[model samples]
Target: MPDTAYNLTVGDFNCTVFSDGCLIDPDETFGLNCILIEAEGRKILIDNGFGENSTGTAGLLLDNMKTVGRKPEDIDTIIFDHGHIDHVCGTFKKDGSPVFPNARYIITREEWDYIKSPPGDNETQNGFYRHARQYLLPLHDRFDVVASDCEILSGITLVPAHGHTPGNVMVDLSSQGERLLCIGDIIHSPREFADPACLAAFDVTPAGAIKTRAKILADAARDGTFVFATHFTFPGLGYIRQINGVFSWAPI
Candidate 1:
């Protein structure tokens, strides 16, 4: 039992990163550093952990949630940074009921479309496409399809960071002059920050993924914003900085 929940303050807002637990597939398959982030007191979850079949990697999310005094019922919003299985499967109970019953789920329209009819050539990695429908179909009534650049809350905006997935997006939070970007699987391992061109095998379009990584790193560096990577070890919160032409991640 590793403590997967962590809290940080950005001006008046409190952000907590909670784990749904971890997945330990080959580093080449799902990327070496995929984790989870939960923002504290906001009643929101960025990405849920993997499901039971993911081995011991599954179910720690509930534990981490409890550590932060957050129960499944307490979540007001469940934001899917992307529709990958490891990130979305934890949304359901063993009986198929939504784990976070009261929260409204938000996902990009592009992501929704991709999940609905993923290309056949990419079936293996995109298999989560089908699972997304299975797990989320029940919540269609509460699912809010958003655009690439939509604001989910007063201080939180969704920034389209396509390439890894057509609708892969990052959540940007601005509160009282402070900023943080919750980047979901953009740069899985911190080492990838040093070479943005290095992408995980799961990347739908390797080249495009690299480009998106570069763009995100540049923006975060320029704005001096904090970054919360969903899969960067436990408590995956850090700041991105650039030296010369290389990017560096400093965990906080």
Candidate 2:
């Protein structure tokens, strides 16, 4: 098996980027990257990849974690960037039990509401929402929904960049002077880094996605901020570059 876990640090916090596996489609391939932040005494997991229910070459989060000496039960907090099935479905086991039983879940209030009352019925685009609810609703009372742009911890911040989903957010981590911005589903394909107009089909709000992508790509390039993308290549650690007025991705 290939190495799926990449360990690093964000200032004082120990961070690891785990590959939940990849989604290979006829036209494109997507890497599922999840982040684990060990801060103080907290074990924070950014997203749990597709669990048990996934079909093809995905759902490797649990095993990847195990290789790093971590387990589902060892997680103390699970912060969801959105309610997409691939990001939230791994919260439950095959028997419908919570995978991270000891962890408290956190998500933007806007996202939680969207999950409960999705855009349409099961037959429509709401199928993903319906599937997500099955794994999330059981832990309804365990979620601590907060407003967008909330600071999750001392160095971890949830920045609102809604577009792909009703309440999608980005994780911004700052420590000492170094910074890393985890743009969840913001630019699924590398080409989008240079062309913000290249929208993914799943983007619920294409206009918002384009606007947010443009802004983020510009800002990251200007500031030279390290970025972690959810669906980019494995480990997805890189810097956004801007020359003249064009943007591009520079993997490190």
Candidate 3:
């Protein structure tokens, strides 16, 4: 298994990228990059990768955390980028217990409602629905559901980027005027930067996904905001640049 953990500073916040290794599908390999942000004496986990329930080289986020001197219990807040299995499964243990027992959770109200709704027709998506229910439903009372773009903390904001999922969001972090957008599954490949219309098969609403991607890429390019992509290669940190209005990924 690939054990990867990288640490960097985001203005006043200490940010760490921990990998749950890679999720290998038939067509592509996705890096399960989860972020840990330490701000205001809070250990906030952006997403929980696949945990004990998944089979494969993935599910290493918890193990990787040890390298940075962090334990599951150390997490005070867990913000789910979405309800996807890869993003929420690590919240629970094989015995149906929460991995981060002491942490409170946050997710968009739309996403929470969708997760509890009836399963969809797509078999693959239904499977994801089941996993989401198993891992997240049990913690219903612990969740703080937000209805719109709002700041959950002093420097972190959950901006509605809904597309990939009903209430999927991108985390906007600002400290001392430096900004980083944790665009969860917004653009899987760097190639998408130049062609924002490109769609990911997992997107529930392809058109919305495309629109959100285009807007984010353009805005990031214009504002010179750094980005942390969830499915990009390990330690997915980069800046978006535009040439002739075509955005491109410039990895740092």
* Per-model tally of clashing residue pairs: 9, 0, 0
Q: What lDDT does model 1 reach?
A: 0.73
Tens digit of lDDT per residue, candidate 2, span 200-240? Answer: 56677778889888888888888888999999898999988
Tens digit per residue, CA lDDT, model 1, 1-252: 335666677666666666666556555323212222334456666767665435665567777667657677877788888888878877887667777778888899998887777346766665756668676776788889999899877788899999988899998887788887888878887668766555456687778888888888898888888888777766677788888977887877
TM-score of 1: 0.88
What order do you get sorting by lDDT, best first?
Answer: 3, 2, 1
What order do you get sorting by TM-score, best first?
Answer: 2, 3, 1
Q: How large is the C-alpha RMSD of every model relative to the true structure?
A: 3.0, 1.8, 2.0
- In candidate 3 the C-alpha lDDT for residue 228 amounts to 97
Better of 1 and 2 by lDDT: 2
Per-residue lDDT of candidate 3, residues 1-252 (tens digit): 224888888889999999988888776787889999999999999999989877887899988999778999999999998998888989888888888989999999899999988887877778776888866787789899886487989989999999888999999999997888999888887767665555466788878999888888888889888999998888889988989977777878
Q: At residue 43, what lDDT does model 3 achieve? A: 95
